[model samples]
Target: MATADAALRDTFTLQGVTAVQPRRPDGGFDWDWRGPRNDPEWAWFFNRHLVFTDLLAAYQQTGDVRYRDRILVTLDDWIAQHPAPSGITFSAAWRPLEAARRVMESWIPIYAALRDDPAAFPPERRARFVASIRDHALHLRNHHAFSGNHLITEMLALTRLGLTFSDLPDAAGWRSYALDRLARAYEDQVYPDGAHKELSSHYQRVVALNYQELLDLLRASGQEEAVREWEPRVHRLWDYFAAIMKPDGTNPLNNDSDTESVAALLRQYAPHIRIPEQTVRLPWAGQVIFRSRAAAAADAAGVRGSGFGVQGSANAAAANNAKPRTRNPKPAAATPPPLLYAFFDTGPRGTDHDHADFLHVSLSVGASDFLVDNGRYTYTPGAFRDYFAGPSGHNVLLLDGLGPDQGPRAVTAAADAAGVQGSGFRVQGSDSRFPSPAGNPKPETLNPEPAASAAPAVEIAWGDTTFASASRPAFAANPRAADWRRLVAHVPGRAWIVVDRVITFSPATLTTLWHWSPECTVEPVPGQPDSLIVSRSSATLHVRHAASQPVPADRQQITARSRPSPQGWYSPRFNMLEPASCTQLDQAIRAPLVNVWLFSPAALPGASIRISADHRIVVQLDPATSLTLDPEAPGKSAVTGTMR
Candidate 1:
């Protein structure tokens, strides 16, 4: 390894070094490994550390005085703003001490590089840096105990520093402790299926960043054997990361994913490990490790394999369901949509991380989002600035219009997990429900899972009374609408919707809320049966079962176009149930009431119904109906009357 003093001797050679910045859409330069922009809170350390680390690497690689000078200028800026009582420095710029620890680690290399260049870093700057480092380490070793990622980073820095200041036993102890913590953290935080608990893209980047440091530390310390030992585990993590990526190169962006450059970083590692250029489509453990290992082998052999770690190897593992240590074989599709489902139980009442979308589920069909989770709006203004992050952002009830309170204190540990089908996932929480119409405040739980193994479908089980039934409604507008007009003469035509769940309703009158928002005008197409055209948008409603023949215009009466107030669009919770007679009401008391919403268009005089188990029909009567759904009901029973 090149010593910092050796590189410092050749500072003049730094003149011609060319840096290839991360690319941008507009062709500008960005240094972000994942992308140009990132969350200010998290990216604070990431960017600062990146610039500092690059400078440190440059100085170390080329003995560049200019690089050390640039780093000192930035370090001084931080020192001036955060001078402590001991003339050290600290920063409140980020939350969760884990973030600060990263900033701490970035300085170790900078210090080593800077200490070698006397002219570039003065005594005062070095003193300040040391003071800050020791203070932070002291606090971390005492106060910050829950930091998983921070422990690894801080331990590495201490280990590096310990080599120089041989008297520090704490540094070595910290390193030992970090290794144990890492194994446990990896076991718990990283699922057996390799899914991350946070599911945030930013966190994925952080994981990569953490691993890079560990790999760098191992490599620099002449511990390549450790890297070889860890190669499989790291490969599994990378494989997990690759599996969650969408075909379009974007992650699902669920949870707290703000960074967009993760795809680029993954590409960078692909060549090193020999992952193919195409998107991965398999669901297996340690895929990234396998691909990387395969890459290493192929690069060494200078040839590709027919069945060894190739891209799109789905059936590879299908033939082997036996336990581990069994010899494994290799295998191999699509413009498949990004279909994901998430459920929030515990009623969005936990910490700021918690969302008030208990019993809420969202679907993304094709590229468009349906029943969406209103993506996060802002992070600085607490959590209330974005109404969508509140209960209103979901398809479920807003609960007497009361959203979760956004206060100063942090809310944590509000989610619970249950495994389904090995790869199946369920996260539940306490206090997950809101007040029902009957004034009963029940705790809601959101239970969501993939509808099938390796399919583009998800089943969300919302254990809340409010989500009794849900149906996706589709409508076609006749004569469409005039260009540039917000209001259009919409000739309502009927389409079919497939309801996945049986309507949970009491023996009373059942009402359905036909809610539409995006603020488009809804015009009632008079005389057309099974039709209503929204002026600004097009809609398609699918029926799960039961076909309807198009009723002629002469047969219908009211052209009821409802314009709901305050929010510009319509959210008409239309009551569609007939009052059951007293005699029959008792019989229907406990059984679920399912409703099929079918609209007919005149052009196709006969309405053709196509049903998949894909539609939603949320009933409104009994809040407890969901708990009673027969576990033995066939998937088809979720929807009846197939007429496609």
Candidate 2:
């Protein structure tokens, strides 16, 4: 309520920017006043009118007439100061996304609260509010969002407005157009496995929230038939979010992403979607989030093989005539070990929030992030933007592009610094070409994924320790480009191994990065230059890199919050930045180079790995348990591990 009171006084802080709006001679607030930073984001928030919603909620809770009157005054001031947009423009006050958000998330709710109060919300003000809503709808009708999550967002607002104002002359047209576009946009943006195509966990949450709201609206208004059509998709979106959750119950900061509340989203739709919670592999999305199962308890609980882990075919039949789970309950442990969670990305680079993070992997021990991607720095395209989106921000092999010293490159320019731009996850938006409406076929990507969001053509091998592999074709325009392949296995609570191989047709340089959480302290293991011990909280992780051959010592470096050349940074929020530690290895590849990274609680004193004549990697975890990783063709899923 204090925040609401401050906002009412024209003192506002939004998105980390704080400023007091100047009062006019008539004591009215300046609606167009941007904060000191003059950030477009701040303006977008101010115009969203979310503060009004907060004031309304406060009034409802405390029965404060001041809060209610604040809404009337500020809203009247806003409508008077800002007129309808002349055309589709990105002025601070009239961006399409914010406009949509203003009505759907803020204004409509405010209107409902004040509509019955004739003195508080007189007929003239009500008419103006409705008129502004019509203008917002007209502007959103022509909006196209780079074929990104914004498309669905704008359409969602239009749909909501049409449904709420059914008596308006244009309401019917608004509903029909917005609904058709939303259905098509949903198809374009969501994968069959339920992952949002932009591939950002933050955006996935945004898209899911929008859909679930639409679904709830449909259900509440007796739109039963429409409800039936949309329920499964909403369920699938939430399912993917559930699969990718860390032990802390939040999604990984992959691509251009930020942290979002996982439980709040689930609370709305989880019960309606009932799918067994376990390790999941979404092949169509080209990703796998592995949840290590307790071996003794899992097997005893009738755990069947999913091809992602230990194959159970040798001991069982395909029939489900096994003992009931209630009868064969899992045994309890006095103290359970912390489960290891891993998020692997080998899919498309996404259309809008594209990141050069192919074959990237994020690891977490319990709730602690060990190997992390420095989400996105900012979308404004600066040094931080390049570093956060390029090879330096993720745990992957960098091929002949951005090296440890290449400073200040944009994502597009980084393509030259690093040769593989848009190599993996062949994005359908070729060079920012979004797919046109249903009948317009000319704008489709050169090689769009099999049309319609269906199960992937080539699926992930499901198991206890899931396996996924991807191959990035040589940079088409670079003669020195190399064909690259990455095969990874998450041994659940055990360990994780990544096999990276590059076939260089010509001389090329490479660098490998292993990003660690800022809380982590990394140092080379005594007398072992090829290994490092990373300590975070009370836990420790040992990371070792062994190439097909040896790498020179001079090529390895530890860059921590350094300047100019290499970047050592992380972003916990959209506009926030913090220094972090990073491990980088440089190399010069002539013929071929294959590198292996083994991450575990600790490396066995005598643990050894062998590379075969056929390029298969075999690691002896101990005398009894061994893992053999065989690389497969790109876009094909196959089981390659012997253990779960």
TM, every model: 0.49, 0.79
lDDT of 1: 0.34
Off by over 4 Å in 1: 1-74, 77-106, 145-170, 219-229, 259-262, 270-352, 357-372, 381-388, 395-644
Residues 516-626, candidate 1: write the lDDT tens digits.
Answer: 323223344466433444322222222122211121112111122222311112111111111110000011112243323332111232333332233322211112211
**Model 2 residue 81 distance off true place after TM-score fit, in angstroms:** 2.2
Give stretches of model 2 more than 4 Å off: 22-34, 142-146, 272-278, 294-333, 400-480, 505-508, 555-562, 612-616, 630-644
Best by TM-score: 2
TM-score of 1: 0.49
Worst 10 residues of 1 by lDDT: 481-490
Backbone clash tally (model 2): 11
